[model samples]
Target: MPEQPAGSRPTLEAVAARAGVSRATASRVVNGGAGVRQPLADKVREAVEELGYVPNQAARSLVTRQSGAVAVIIAEPEFRVFSDPFFEQQVRGISRELTANDSQLVLLWVEGPGDHDRIARYLGGGHVDGALAFSLHHDDGLPALIRDSRVPAVFGGRPGSGSGSGAAVPYVDCDNRGGARSAVRHLAGLGRERIAHIAGPRDQTSAADRADGYRDVLFDADPALTVQGGFTVDSGARAMAELLDRRPDLDAVFAANDLMAAGALRVLRERGRRVPEDVALVGFDDVAGVAEAADPPLTTVRQDIEGMGRLMVRLLMRVLSGRDGREAGAPASVIMPTELVRRASA
Candidate 1:
């Protein structure tokens, strides 16, 4: 083989010459050898190794019309994303799945409304092959922006079109309503009357579903028995306080997520409320470290947060793989199951 110049990047032509093959054939081999014969691929690889040649990723993506990267967008503030174990679990699953598939993960945080335009431009620019978005509020315009960009995307929770039309968007979410129902039923079985619900933000579907589930159990549900929370521990504590003020006789409480439940636990502890004995308590999400660490170990609804993340990436990948780079005709949205993990709190 001819000696390469000092400080010069090895070129494809040199590898092709060393391999005794056409440059196009060598290119195919270096770019994953999809149709090249095994012996020919081996030869190209050997030549590449001999020459210390590295295929330029930008040029490769241009040829394939694919970035070979996937974006994981979380529509939340940095504090919440960093503090919440739920987001951490989801991202871990996404990273694992994307890594196993030899794809890059580009994490994006939508901190403010301005980020939407920037994210839309990024998606439209073909910077990533696909996107996995999560935590959309009903009023959030992300779904519309994504649809306009024409990039295949899968959401972690059921997302509205940011318009009231409720246009279709493929997603993977757990059975939130059913899980809430189960939690309420358990509390009722404990013979706790005046059950109260601490719901999350009403604009998000998951929160809305959980709230609806609470109402399904208690038809003609007392308006005062339900208080809204922001899915944060502080919000949970505040909402719990409001519930106590409204109905001190309330015998049980159900919070939308474990974070809020943990908050409620603190408030209950402060107010001299005993867990399960004086007032039974339950929470959702069963987030690691939050539920089990609560005084008296929380009994909560468990959704596979990481599993849902993996499934979201899997679904978007399927759509990205569609023929002619178009979506594969909208594969049906998926809803994963949830469980009511029994523990000491209940």
Candidate 2:
């Protein structure tokens, strides 16, 4: 036998010949594609292991037109991405679901304004199968870009109507409005009329939806008292303090999320306001850690983030398969439900 060059590498044909299978079958087996017979698949796997065959992503993409990878693009601050428990849970859910399907998850962080164009290029590059976008602001054109790409894509939450195209963007989101209502209703059940809201950023769809829920519920109740606290700890503290100053008679508060609620709780303690006694409080996204660690514990709304991740993947997979046939008017919304978790706070 002739000796190959020192740096020469094994190719798909080499593995196919060794496995006694066609190159196409070897390719399918190596790329984890379905429908391959078990014995042939095992032979290809054994051949791959013996020869140390590594499949070229470019070649695979050429044949399958799929990179066997999905991108999860998040535009939040890096600190928030790493530190937020809600984000942690979301990542876990997404990871678990994607891994089960033998697909890769690419986490892209779009930190500054400069990152937008680069993100567009990455998505347009045909290097990924699809995308799951998160943390988009009101005016960000990401939704439209993803839609126009004609690639399978799903949003983590609704992007607001700042760009007009947001209304038609396909997304998988928790029922923020309904969850917020449940939280408020629970507080109302405890006879807390002077309820205030520590809301998230108005630009975000989740924040806006949550605010709408609180507003909708409060409108039906007797005195409509409310305020907005941008979705941060400091914002919540400041907003809670201001609300207390304005309405010392306020008896309850509904923070739009658990982080904001935690902040409000700290302020209440500092101001010597008794929890549940003086002001019952409720929060959204029952982030397990903060809920358990809160001074008086917390009552919160819980959404199955893992289920959302799995469902988003399934939807995107359907889009990838061309089963639904992507069209402009094919129902651009996928809303998930939420539930209230009662505890000492409310």
Candidate 3:
């Protein structure tokens, strides 16, 4: 490398020379690798500060063949993932675990059509240590991409898109159907009949599973209830609005997520209806913003979003360490539990 004039950035060689160590040692120290002694490590640290050295991630990735990083891919709009409390909580959990393990987290937002192809290329090219995929839909073709990559991957939920019962890679998921059932059953217990459901996207396992739970319990309870919604607030609002138009006597609504439930409430309020008095509403995901900010508060099904993120990281670490529980003849699906939070909505 060419020597620079005064005030230029320091290279790895400069740090190595200043620390009286090899360039490789300087690189390792900068990347946070273990095994360097305190004296040498201290020298490298001091030299790094004195020289204002910064390690190039791409160069380091080439040397280690491990980026010291992982990617979290969500198949949804950036706003949806960024705005939702669930994503924020999960990201915090994921970051906590990754930072503890000395790894970095990279987030990839895949919302546009044909973007999965680009993502597949990126992952397949060995850009990340592994990948964590979430919110897959039926026609998304994401599973096939990950399957073809041969890189280690962990899904957030069971894939509702494919016929395959089990995953080639391990997955962590919440008990969606059970949670939905609990929410709907609670509404029934409140003596609210003519219930309508604002469901999640049909392709997502959480959405389908939750919708199924609501449908099964509602049919068993009243046999006249129905469901609709695609897990968005707009979907919830539209579904709620339509249900009200069709069945003016509908007394209850179950939304697939808090955002959707919030939408349903807005639509209800707009049409001059009272919540819990005119129509009881329930939502899943117990997201903080919508759950707490609703007109009369929201009754929602809650999952440990942060725990899920941490658990996913743990599973990936196991894979990287070659001690994966499922691969070691343990149970495959690690299903996390859910809770129903009571509020004024239902």
Question: How high is the CA lDDT of each candidate model?
Answer: 0.88, 0.81, 0.82
Residue-by-residue lDDT tens digits, candidate 3, 190-212: 99877887777777888889978
Query: Residue 284 of candidate 3: its Cα lDDT?
Result: 88
Query: Candidate 2's C-alpha lDDT?
Result: 0.81
User: Best candidate per lDDT, number?
Assistant: 1
Q: Candidate 3, TM-score vs. the true structure? A: 0.81
Model number with the top TM-score: 1
TM, every model: 0.84, 0.81, 0.81
Per-model tally of clashing residue pairs: 0, 0, 0
All candidates in order of lDDT, best leading: 1, 3, 2
Task: For model 2, name the residue pairs that clash.
Answer: none
Minimal lDDT window, size 10, model 3: 323-332
TM-score, cand. 2 vs. native: 0.81
Say which prediction, candidate 1 or candidate 3, comes out ahead on lDDT.
1
Task: Tell me how far the alpha carbon of residue 165 in candidate 1 is from the true structure, in angstroms, after superposition.
Answer: 8.4
Residue 19 displacement (Å), model 2: 15
